[model samples]
Each structure stands twice: as C-alpha cells, then as structure tokens.
Target: MGYFVPVEPGVNLFVEDINQEGSKTIVFIHGWPLSHKQFEYQFNILPALGYRCIGIDWRGFGKSDKPISGYTYNRLADDIRMIVSTLQLDNFSLVGHSTGGAIAIRYMSRYSGYGVSKLVLIDAAAPTGFTKETAKDLLKETLNDRPKMMQGITDTFFFQYITSSFSDWFFQMGLEAAGWSTAAIIKLLRDEKLDADLPKIDKPTLIIHGIHDKVIPFAQAQELDQKIRNSQLVPFQYSGHGPFWEERDKVNQLLTQFI
Candidate 1:
C-alpha cells in the first residue's frame, strides 16, 4: 500500500509503504527528476530479504502532490520528518540517491537521527552543494532549454555504452518530473550549501559513488567521507552517475551488506 502523508494543508507527499513483518526498515529516496519508482531494484528485493522498504516520492516529484513552492532542502527535510513522525518509524535506515542524498543529509542534521539509524548515500550529491560557477552556468543553461539539457544529460552522463531502452527509461523519468520542480531544484542546488550539516550526522554512514559519474563528480564522495567522520566510501569502477542502475548487482550486494 501507499500513503499520501500531508506535508502542508493541501500538499500530500506520496510514500510507497512496502511494509512487511519486520523491525528494521529502509526508506528509499529518489534522485532528481525521478520518484520512488526509481528504487524499483530495492523495494521488493529488500522486503524479501527480511527488511521493510518504504520509498518516498518527494513533494513535487513522482506521484506526490506538485506544490508550487517548498522545493528547498529545508522544506524537503521537514517533509521527511513528517513522514517519519506519521509512520512512527524507529531504528530505520535512510537511503538516498543523487540529490536525495543531500535531502537525507539535511534531514539527519535537522532531526539528529530521530527515527533514523543508518545512512546510505548512493551516487549522492552530498556534504557540499552544487554551488560552483560551472554548475551555476549549467543551471542557467538548463533553465533556458530543458529539452536540450536533458538530451545532453542522457548522452554524456550515463555509462558510454548504455542501451537504447535504458537511455529511454532515464529520459522518460526526467520528462515525468514536474518542470517547475526541476527548474527550482537546479537553482536551489546552485545556491544551497550543505557543509555545516555534514558534521551533524553521527550515525553509521556509507558513501557509495561511481568513478565515472559525470553529473556529480566522484571527488565529492571523498569530500563527503572526510566530513562525515567514520563514513565509508565505495567507488563503482564501471559505473556513472547511476550506479544503482549501471551496476545493479554490485550496488545491491553493497546495500544488502551495509544494512
């Protein structure tokens, strides 16, 4: 089943509550321009392995309500807090991919690991925000021509030899995301900073990154590891920005072991 947890009076966030008879839970948060559905590789597999899996479609993405505002990390973290409070989750794990990783970090910093136990960032945009001059210019370019920006992403970001079907899937996922949310998020990424929040996360943290990631540089993982004390970083040699999909087997193995 699913839950449309209310974030605001009229805004409800969609959460795919794949609850099973288990104590340890895993909440999967998707990356930019995608929804909980992006974690298709994790939800069912984790439950079968005796872990409860819940995937959240952040406000304005996936099946969640597309509100005009509240697209920043602070508000997104608050939305996550509402979900945890509503579900009464405890000793749970939060797994975030790409931009979702930043959101997860924000949540942990804000709540001090309220119901969260372990943290896993897969090919995440972390500790430091995308506030570089180059990123700013790219954001402006994306805002100017979204379709072209998306095409460029699919062509240059993913592993060089990805199949047509896989490329199409990624493109479709991007297209499915709301234009307003996408544009606002790009601007927010360029302006927001997460350096202070990094040290606040004291839980067991795992930083998984792909060496070939063209979207968010793999070097960011090193920076994240340095900031989050005792965090482990695993680099996928053959993957790109999406290790979960690019190197599914390895990503699954690492996730299963981490949890």
Candidate 2:
C-alpha cells in the first residue's frame, strides 16, 4: 500500500510512512548500486510495531533521477536534509546499510542530529581503511570509458560476498532497479570517506554486521563500535553482507531491541 511521495526532484527522493499515522518514523537508506526496494522487506513489514518506515533512493539510484552530476557525498546528504526538514519529522530514527550508513553518518555529523534520534547501521561502511589506493587504481581504468554507461556492475560487484541463491537477485535485479552507472559507481567508490566524521556522532547507534561479510568486512563494524561513543555492535555468525536478507528473523529481533 505505497505510492510515490515526491520531492524537489534534484536527487529524486521517495518517501513512505504509516498508513494512518505514526509518532515515530524509521528512515531506511539503501546501499550503493541498490534502490530503496532492497529494503522491500522492511517497508512491507515492521508496521506491526506501529512504525512509519520510509526508505529513500539516493541520487543515481532507485526511482530517484539518475543525473550525470551531483554525486558527491555532500550533495546526496543535502538532498536528504531537505527531505527530513520538508516532512517536518521529529524524533525520527534512521537505518542505513553499507554506503547508506556512510551517508547517514555524514549527515548526522554535519547536522548534529536535527530530526534523527536513533541510528542503526547494518554492515556499514566506515572509511578507516577505505583507502584511496585501491580505488585510485580501479578509477584510473574507469577513466578510459565513454560518457554514457553500457555495462552492469553486478557481474563482479559482489564477487566475494555472493552465493548461488543470493547471486541472481541482489546484484542483478536489485541493482538494476537502482539505475547506477559504472562511472557513477566508480566515482562513488573512489572519492568518499566517512571515517573523518564518525567520531562526532552524539546519537545512539547500532552497528550490525555479518561475520562472513566480505564486502565491507566485520572489522569495519568493530571499528565503528569502538569509535562511536553511544554505539553497540551485533554480529551475525552465519550471515554475509546482507544480514537482514540472510537471517531476517534474528535481524528483526536485534532491530526491535535497538530501536
């Protein structure tokens, strides 16, 4: 029971909350090369707790406009800042995964928790060792490309974290919905660092990571838990990068307690 709740169309924000009304809102921001639909489970479910769960498609991803510019972390955060203030939301909570988590941290650090009350990061990307060395290498190769993107990043995107059953979906269908280009992804992966802003968070944060997560690695979550003063870390032994999809029931239980 959802429809397109629109914004100014710069970054193309889409929002959904409670059917009738809700006191608290949960804003879920999806990861890189993935749309808000990656959180389709969270949007459809989680209402039993009477929560208004909303997910946003970042610039160049999801139903959002896939522009040729404004891909910087600051630009994306600015778009989200407008969305929250426009809705006039208060005491809101945020849940972000991987790249989404990095954006959340960046937003919180700069704005100092304007509307955000609680923060939950699932397999977040903290820029501790998100060194520019490896990225500089890959991006150098990406520079030889043309203006328009022609290939899918899914083929080798999650080569390390993907399994047989999970392979066909998260990268192929899910990433396609986001509409991210190879150049956009390369730039994004190459030129962003959230570690500089993490130590300044004042809000309560929950870091969820999978022990088997090869994408961002479990140590990244540990580093976040160590740095964030009011944060806790949860580890999923059998799960990979996407714990919510891997072990949903347990992930829900952890989220229930976190929020």
Candidate 3:
C-alpha cells in the first residue's frame, strides 16, 4: 500500500508499505536523486519473504512534496521521525542507501535510534569529506545541465551491465526530482559531517559497501565499521555504488539473515 504521510505543514512524504502483516518490518530510505522506487528489487523479494517493507520517498524527490527549504540532514531525519511515530513503528530494521544512509545516521543520533532494532547502510555516504570547490562545481553543473550531470552519475553508478532501457529508467528517476532539491542535497552532502553521530549508534549495524564504489570511497565504509561499535562491514566486490541493485540477491540474503 502507498500513501502520503505528513511530516510538516504542507509537506507530506510518499511512503510505500508492503506486506503489512509480515512478522518483521524493514524501513528503507533511498539515496540522493532517487526515491523509494530505488529499492524496487528489494521490495519485490522482501515482501514475499514475510518482511514488512516500508520505503519512503524523501521530500523533494519521488512523489513527496517539494519545498525550497528543509534539505538539511536534521530536518530530513525529523521527517523520518514523524513517519515512525505516525505509523507506530517499533523494533524495526532501518535500511538506508547513499545519501539516505547519511540521513539514517542523523536519524539514529537525533532520535536516539527510536523504535529501530537493527541498522543497515548500503553503500552509504557518511564519514565523508569533499572540498568546497568540488561541491560548488557539482552544484553549478547540476543547475546548468542536470541531464548531463545525471548521465555522468548513471554511467558510474554500476559495475555490472545494465540494459539500455534499464539505464533510461534509472536516469528518468533523477529527472523526476526537483532541480532545487537536488542541488540542495548536493550542498548537504558536501557540508554535513557525521563523525560525531557514528559513535552514538548503539544498534547492531550492518554496513554494506561496494569495494569499487566511486561515489563514496570504500574507506568511508571502513571508517564507519571502525567507529560504530558492534557494526559489521560487508564488502560487495562485484559492485559499484549501487550494490543493492547490482547484487540484489546477495543483498537480499544478507538482509534476511541480518534483520
């Protein structure tokens, strides 16, 4: 089932909830320039395995409300808190990818890991550092020619072969997002640091990172594994930045066993 859940005044996030009566619940937060749709592969399998899969389309992406403001990690995490509260979700596994991983980290810290039992970060972008110049150039490119920028991301997003039609579908997902929101998130990625938040996560965490990930270096995952106590790092050797799709079967199996 899918519906809009209010996060703030005039701001409602699109949520896809499946297998509502499943024994276990897993909440998915997608990365930048994408939506809940990013986890289509996982959603297809997890639900059938008796896992309640909940995916949230961040505001300004997917079918969620698009506002010019509130792109910061704090507000983004707060939006998730509202969803958890409204749904009365507890003892659930939280999964996040890319930028969604960073937001998940913020959620863990800001909300004290409320109602979450296990944490899964897939090719997460946290404990990262980027120069201001790089951020500025990326933002400029994003605003000036988003198609080219998105194409570049799509080109480097995967290590495995993706069909032309599949590539087009992925590219279209980026286009569906508001341009301003996209740029705002770029700034957030550049500016925000989750060094302090890492140690605060007390849940049993699983960090799944692709060894060949170019977007967020493999070292960041190493840092996350070292800092987050009781965390295990699983490297996806045959994947790039998107192991959840590039190696869906392994990811699903790992998630099933872990969660």
Candidate 4:
C-alpha cells in the first residue's frame, strides 16, 4: 500500500509500503535527483524471497511533495523517522543509495536507529559528505547553470555501458525533480558534516560500493567500513556508482547473503 505520509503540516512524503506476511521489512531510500523508482529492481524481486520492501521518495523528489525548503540531512532523516514511526516498523533493515545513504546515516544517528536491525549502503555517499573539494566548484557552477551541470553529472557518473533506454529513463527520472529543490539539496549535501554520524551507527552494516565509481570514490567505502565498527565492505569489481543497475545479479546475491 502507498500513501502520502505526513512529515509536517502540508508536507507529506510519498511512501510505498509493500506488506508480505511472514517476511522481514527492508526500507529502501533512493538517491538524489531520483525517486523510490531507483530501487525498482529490489522491490520487484525481494518480496517473493520473504522480504517486504518499503521505498520512500525523499521530499522534492519522485512523487513526494516539494516544499520551498527543508532539504537538509536532519530534516530528511526526520521524514524517514516519521515513516518508520507511523508504520510501527520494527526489526527492519534500511538500504540507502547515494545521498539516501547519507540520510540513512543521519537517521540512525539522530534517532539512534530505534527500530532498525541492519543497514545496507549501496554505492552510498557516506562519512565524507560529497568527497571532493572540486564538488564545491561544481556546486557553484550548478547554481549558475543547473541544466549544464546536470548533463555533465549524467555523462561522467551515471551511464557507461548501459543501453539507450536505461540512460534515457535515468534522465527522465532526474527531470521529474524540481531544479530549485535539486540546488537546495546539493547545497545541504555540500555543507553537511557526517563523520560523527558514522560512528553513531551501532548496527550490523553492509557497505557495497562500485570500484569504478567516479561520483563518490571507492575509497569512501573503505573509510566507512573503518568508521562503522561492525561493518563489512563488499567491492563491486566491474560496477560503477549504480551497482543495483550495473551489476544487479551480483548485488542481489551479495545483499541476500548479507541480510
């Protein structure tokens, strides 16, 4: 079942809660410029394997309501908290991709991971917020010319050997997000300090990162593993930033084993 779960008055997040009897819940958090659709692969297959999936599009992305503000990490984490509390979710795992991974880290740290059992970080933006000093220059350029910067990001980070249809779909999904919202979110990410949040995560964590990731480097995964005490790092040898799409079978197999 899917509904707009209220985060604040007049601000509700679109959440998809797929319930399955006798199955564990896995809440999926999508990355920036994308929606819950980012985890479509997992949602399609995980439930039949005795795992229910919950995917929520962050505010200003996907089908979620877009306010003029509130794109910061703390605010996003609170939104997730509202969903978990509203659904009475317990003993579940949180799987976050890209910026969603940073939000997951904030959620656990801010809320102390109240009902979470484990965490899965897939090519996530972690410990270090955006990972490059050059990102500051990019963000500046993005503020001036969003469309141009977005095209550069897509070309350099997103598509590699993927088909035309897949790449087109990615571009379409990104286009669904508002330009102002994208800028605000990027500003928050650029300014965020998550080093303290990393160690606060006291759950069994699995970090899966693509070795060839240019968006958020592969070294960040190693850094995350080092910070999170009880965490395992799994490198996707041939995959890039989008492992779930680039190496779906391998990622799914590894995820199943981890959980």
Q: TM per model? A: 0.93, 0.82, 0.98, 0.94
Who is ahead in TM-score, 1 or 2? 1
The global Cα lDDT (0 to 1) of model 4 is 0.84
Model 4: CA > 4 A from native: 131-145, 158-160
Q: Write one digit per residue (lDDT tens) for candidate 3, span 1-259.
A: 9999999999999999999999999999999899999999999999999999999999999999999999998999999999999999999999999999999999999999999999999988897645588678779889999998889889999988999999999999998899999999998988889999998999999999999998889999999999999999999999999999999999999999999
lDDT of each: 0.84, 0.70, 0.94, 0.84
How far in Å is the alpha carbon of 112 misplaced in model 2?
0.7
The TM-score of candidate 2 is 0.82
Q: For residues 1-259, write the lDDT of model 4, one tens digit per residue.
A: 7889999999989988776573688889998878988777877777778888899988898899999889889999999999998989999999999999999999999999979999999888877656357567667766787667766666766434867687677777876777778878777767787899988899999999989998889999999999997999999887888888878888777777877
lDDT of 1 by residue, 164-236 (tens): 8977887777777677888788877778888999999999999998899878899999999999976999989
**Residue 159 error for model 1, in Å?**
2.0
Worst 10 residues of 2 by lDDT: 145-154
Per TM-score, the best of the predicted structures is 3
Error of 2 at 243 (Å): 0.5
| Clash number by candidate, in order | 0, 1, 0, 0
Which stretches of candidate 1 lie above 4 Å from their native place?
131-144
Clashing pairs in 3: none
Poorest lDDT segment (10 consecutive residues) of candidate 4 = 151-160
> What's model 2's overall lDDT?
0.70
Find the number of clashing residue pairs for candidate 2. Answer: 1
